[model samples]
Target: MSRKNRHEEHEEHADESWLLPYSDLMTLLLALFIVLYAASSVNISKLEELSKAFDNAFSSGISILDKSALIEAEDEQNKSQKQRHEEIGIRTQQEKLMAQEQEDLEKLKKELDQYIDKNGLVTQLETQLNQSQLMITIRDNALFASGSADVKPTAQKLAVAIGLMLQKYPDYEVLVSGHTDDHPISTSEFANNWELSSQRALNFMEVLLQNQAFDPKKFSFIGYGEYRPVDTNDTEAGRAKNRRVEVSILRKYTDSSATNTVLSAISDEANSAPSTTTSN
Candidate 1:
């Protein structure tokens, strides 16, 4: 009876040994499910970190998760570099266009200057190239009679000449502005300096439009009246300077320093060149 009891206890011990292996198998399956859930939810960067941890712990080689993260990072970097290169190319093209525009304006200025010299109109007309615009200033007396807005019949020829010269650059925006001396005036045709100045600018602009080549949409006109004077109204000479009409060719791109450099170069060339006029 004692021997049989010992045998029964041994059998029970051996059966429990099988249970230990079964419990271990269940634990391993639970761990695999948890790993699968984490992988599905984690981002690539986090997955790479997890892969590194697994590699260290198990002495495994490079994981597929790490390789995928590295490839994505490299693709992002390449896309960023491509975007930078495209922006640089666009900037370079814009710069080239601006340079071409500046060259065209400079050529136009030279042609107009030569015409002014040839006609001996320097006393009545002046041209200035600046950062904002290329301005052509004409004495009001050259265009209109005293207190009158009508352009003088002889002076219409000058307007025609200027209009023809402007035809070369049809794309530029043109502004015609009229200014007057501070001397107050009330007449049958004009109630004040404002009306007089406005009519003068309008009439002058009309003459400029006679050349069918100009785009009327690109032209604008304004009257400054007695205000916006360039010279003091105290003296006759100053008043003469103050009463003027300005035709401004507006610039598409304005840079003061770059314009100054261009102006300096133009001035140097003018000073060195012979004082001779050539017909356009």
Candidate 2:
């Protein structure tokens, strides 16, 4: 009775024991599926971060293909971050290039001012470096006699000086704009002040370009007449201020580019340059 009982017990135990290992395997598979579902629902950035954490934790000196998928996921995230950094770097470089161009223009403006003061050209021509362009304003009386479009000999000399100064800098567009006082012009050569002012500006531009040293590609002329006056036409003083010609040097970069795109436009010359002028 004892022998039969022991043998039966051993056979039952052998068959039933196999269920323990099978149940353990099934439980592990269920847990793995649950983990996969959770990971799939996570945001990409956080998923990448979590994968990296797993890589550091499970790095063993064995050939396990288990880490390959996680490593690939982390690598993709790293690549995306690196691309963003590179884009930012390119933008920064472009901004720096624009800033340097602005600085160079400011330096040129200061030189022009010194030339104006040294040659006693004040009351005749004044300089201004603004956001869009560098402007050199010349009073009409200095360039032409009243009711005349012909540029005076003194004005020709002034143009030559300014033209020579411009040659020192890189090629840039030069706009020679003519403006005039509100007074009506009834002259033999012109019908209205507009025609007279425009002719004067064109004549001045011609004088400046005569040297051949000036690049024709960089020059343009426009006449605003009395319409674009700097001052009111109601008074003699206002008319005097309004009757002028302006030579504007167009900058490659605009004000918005420097102020918004670049780090800052803190030009030493711009800061120190005179903000306003007065005629005696």
Candidate 3:
């Protein structure tokens, strides 16, 4: 009787067998999730090695994660090839545009040359075509009065004619630049060569812009005064040559080596050509 009472008094032990396997299952789930996250962001070279690890861990020849990695790599390659093709297309289009620009400029130069020759205006105007731009250099006396920035009444027709020609190239940027001889001048009406040159360019540009067909935004003017000169300022004839107005139709695209070659050819032609203006 005493032994039976002692056995009943002994505490009941709880079942602890379920915990070990449950903990192991949670650990495995965490590792799987970690591997999936890494696979998404990893480099292709590293992801291949990780795909092998996934196969080893799952005891399979190829896991779902490995298939995902293959899909990602294929997508990246396709994107790269597409981008390269787009770049090639853009470059080809640019080349075509430049070729057309050159052809148009050449045609315009010939037309202007014909007009100058037919009108007996070769002595007052000249044109040069190069890779950089098509330049029209006009003698100052042809457009402006002595010691004045105002355009002459007779020159209005010339301006209107040039404006008509420029209407075809609405996209080109036209730069009208004024240059002056080194002789100094200061007066109530005019201060110096800078003011004189600037006014000359502005006034002429206004005349060109009066034509509604020409876009005002595509035109600009500047004054170089006596700083930029094509001829020497030491002699009267040279000074007359130096004081001139130039209109340059700028190039949209430029390649330095190609431009240099074209410029050299133009220079050779210019040196061989006869003088367009005589000394005042």
By lDDT, the better pick of 1 and 2 is: 1
Task: List candidate 1 stretches off by more than 4 Å.
Answer: 1-53, 56-79, 255-280
What TM-score do all the candidates reach, one by one?
0.66, 0.60, 0.67
Candidate 2 TM-score, true structure as reference: 0.60
List candidate 2 segments past 4 Å from native: 1-90, 256-280
Q: How many angstroms is residue 168 displaced in model 1 relative to the true structure, after the best TM-score fit?
A: 0.7
lDDT per model vs. reference: 0.81, 0.75, 0.81
What is candidate 2's lDDT per residue for 130-244, written digit by digit as tens?
7777889999889888778889898888889888888776477777877787666565577666567668878999998987877887777766667666778889889899989
Full ranking by TM-score? 3, 1, 2
Residue 138's lDDT in candidate 1: 97
lDDT value, residue 238 of candidate 1? 89
Tens digit per residue, CA lDDT, model 1, 23-88: 999999999999999878858898899988988756666567877899999999999999999999
